[model samples]
Target chain A: MDRNFPQELLETIQKADRAGAQAVIDAWAVGRPFHRVIPELLSPTLETFGRLWASGKDGVSLAEGYVAAKVAEDVLSRVLLDASGDGTPRPSSKGPVLVGNVEDDFHPLGRKMVAAFLRADGWEVHDLGVDVGPAQFVDRAEETGARVIGASAMMFTTAKNVAKLREEIDRRGLGNRVQLAVGGAVFKLRPELVAAFGGDGTAASALEASALFARLARRASEARGEVPA
Target chain B: MNSLERVLAALQNRSSDRPALLLNAGLYGARLTGAALKDHYRDPEVFAEGQIAVREAFQPDLLVSPFALAGLGAAFGSRLSESSRRPPNVAAFAADSAEAALRLPLPDVDSHPQVGYLRDSIRILAKRYAGEVPVIGLLASPLDLPPLIIGLEAWFDALLFQPETARALLDHLTPFFVALGRAMLHDGATALALTANLANRSILPAPVVERLGRPSLEQALAEIPGPVILHHGGCPLLPHLADFKGLPNTVGYVVDAGEDLAAARAALGPGPLLLGNLPGPTLGDLSPEDIGALCDRALSRRAADLQFILATCGADIPLDTPADRLEAIADRVHRAGRVEA
Candidate 1:
């Protein structure tokens, strides 16, 4: 991965320079596949933007994340469209994935990043956004037929809410069909929390999250004696 | 030595009977002292009575007000709602943008009812303790205040995009803090505990904290007459240790329990007192014996460091935390102090 493009994209996003950030992505994506562009270029760029914003560098804001997401979305949509060549009969064989911040936790940048990465990785993603309750996650998964649900909790206090979602899934007997995946600063600090809170797995970062969910989804399918699509 | 003497000795690097324990026994005060948490925060009389009762029962070195962090924002005209289980929180934010935030008026501390309630409670506790136990008043840090007035997303956005506006907002809020600090000191608060949750690496990076959060904090600390303890929730204070070192009159740094004490001690060096890393959030799950064991371990790890104090990393111990656990901590520290003495 050339660090130059990601570094430049991070600066542009931090400045809330959406046009410049988009241009950078567009320029880089020329004659390249999104699978290469996303994991290598766009995801790393967003991660840098997140780190810089977290660093509290001058002119960095939560809004920068919104801008970065927009740029990633623009590049992703164009690349996917180019690959499909007219968008007439493209079908997603990958099952839908549900992602959100646990109830009472409003920090959603990581979850948004995961949603974007999952989309780029050829999975259907339903982002429930921030402060999503346990019931909402289960209901959305049921509605969307999502095979995996990803919950991000930023604090130890709200991270406890993830357990509630776990219990609800168990009670619904959807534990086998729907796997619960958790991440965030708390999980990074305490990795054991993923299993302790009844989650099937945990990811350390956005890219890892998308990969973790793919593996979990495949394992679920294998358990049901079906070939992973 | 009494609790106050023990803490004072530790702060001055003088020999003490034992390590001073500043357990955040504030939230547990209501339940242990027979005052409802709601009444304890809403009524000055109940607040003082509850604190005194808890002090008598647990006998920790400091008495902290259990008032929610929303008081300052509420005083500045943000809507606050009181609850029975926990402290009041901002029901509504006052501003959404940097320009609007800068224009928000500075609240007169004297005119705010909640401020008066807290001040009265401080005076009552101070007079009751009468130089024995220090009554520390809780004030939201300048960095922590903006998110309360303007919603957190907006405040953080301003921090990333509009640096000057964020600083201006911090500057605007600093006087209110200075006034609040002065009033608390005047009313007998022996020290001021500023909750700077945003200064942690989990939220803001060190450089941004150094640039924006540190200056406003310095301004507020300069006006504060007594010792100022900055309590930041989250661990690995290594990043912000330098910024913490630069602040004036900061006698102690209260970091969360997950931090490596030895690393923090080495990073902080010998000047400032290292007050905590006791797992606060897990207090509800641990028995008194368990808590005592944890405290004993922490004390043993820093046994050679005289400036160490056993305290919680977070401000309020959970409301449901057992009184016995708090007592166990205090008793363990007392035994350690006596044995050392």
Candidate 2:
């Protein structure tokens, strides 16, 4: 949450100096344990990037957002891998989450970006991959106990299949147990469909997806009467 | 005035009683023919028949040829699936990688059915209309074709991380688009609806697009030899209007619904026609009243811009979109009445 951290990182990302951005992160993490670096600095910095991207006033393009996320992803992943004193990398405690292009929707760009951003924020992302069915999304979330499901579809037609995820969730009475986040080109182009598609929420950009999942998780926690982390 | 004359009036920014209606009722047209959407996509006769059927019902100013960008992909050897209700998604790629794509030969539009379907539809409609209406054919620009051929993720990966490789792919794909676009024009297309999403700011930064995407586009547009309308490709165009103005043969842009029309018109400087932006993909879900509100708002906003065409924007119109919803838009454009000179 330090003010000085994000501005420097933002400048590096804006200039598209990936190595410089990594160097900035490394400087911040030099004294701090790398694992704590995410919750303390990296996550908040990503939030700043998300706001800048969503604002569009400062002129952050998707390519920049993708680059920033890629940098964040590379940093967070390496730290998470090295966090354990043991060689094996333990998953982030941010909780389980699933992402996929909804059944019959094979466009992978949006979904891939979402995975990167979530992984950057230390969310344990189970990429359901493309051409995923509705039952499979819910069943995997059930099997994995993932608190959030990000369903992506590029076209309005393929996006319609996302509704089946809502149906599967409700049919299994997992509404309060898990949250559905609908997105992709369709929702971006036709935003009114977020609620129409039964999404608990939708992020404006991939960098924002992690925060959306957190909010959804908190809501699900409240519904289930669990203490918020 | 005939539909063509009205469209010409809009294109000329001439004083007119109304804004020309350029509804892209392509996928929606398949329903009118009583054939499956996939069937209509393949059979030029059925496809043109559907466009004709909709033309009878709606009386749009611009007659749309098959707007499926996938048809161009199919010409390169991609096969699509899950196209029953909507436009088919390319299930298989023409070439899975930039290397393989480079090795793939350019399709002869005259021989390839995928590309020929486009030319055939334009040929059929232009003959049927015979100067009564203008047939606008959809053509994917050179920079946009990598996503169609190699896959969206792979292409974007190469574009973002492997710049030289992406430029090489663009160099290879540029002539194919030029050839098909020129062929479509020669076959009787009044204009080409060129999908140039790569040029839009939302998709890529201006510097990146200007440096990487624009050169190929300028090259392709120079050779097409016909009027070109830059499509939003489901992205906003207002920010890039001034830049797009210089592309040869580009006379209009299909604006996104979310953009400020006044700003777009100002950016375009009254020279280029603006055709768009009813949210087409959600047409089936919106009520008639919602459709009217959107139409009424778009009409009022651009009511003064003489070079304005009222039409749908963002992805294909859902096939199941109620006919009445389209008629609702059509009726509004028709009843929009005279714009002040």
How many steric clashes between backbone atoms does each model show?
Answer: 7, 0
lDDT of 2 at B333: 90
Q: What TM-score quantifies how close candidate 1 is to the native fold?
A: 0.83
The DockQ for candidate 2, computed on C-alphas, is 0.51
Scored by lDDT, the top model is 2
Question: For all the predictions, what are the DockQ values?
Answer: 0.19, 0.51
Q: On residues B1-341, what C-alpha lDDT tens digit does candidate 1 reach at each position?
A: 78788778878887887787776766667777677766787788887787887777867788886547777777777877565555665657777676797887887788778788888888889998986998898888778888678766677667765788888888788888888888998999988888776665445544567687777777778877788887874545555677677587788888667577888888888878888877775676678878888888888898878788888765466666776777788788878843342
Task: Provide the overall lDDT of each model, using Cα atoms, as 2-decimal numbers.
Answer: 0.75, 0.82
- Give model 2's docking category: medium
List TM-scores for all candidates, in order: 0.83, 0.91
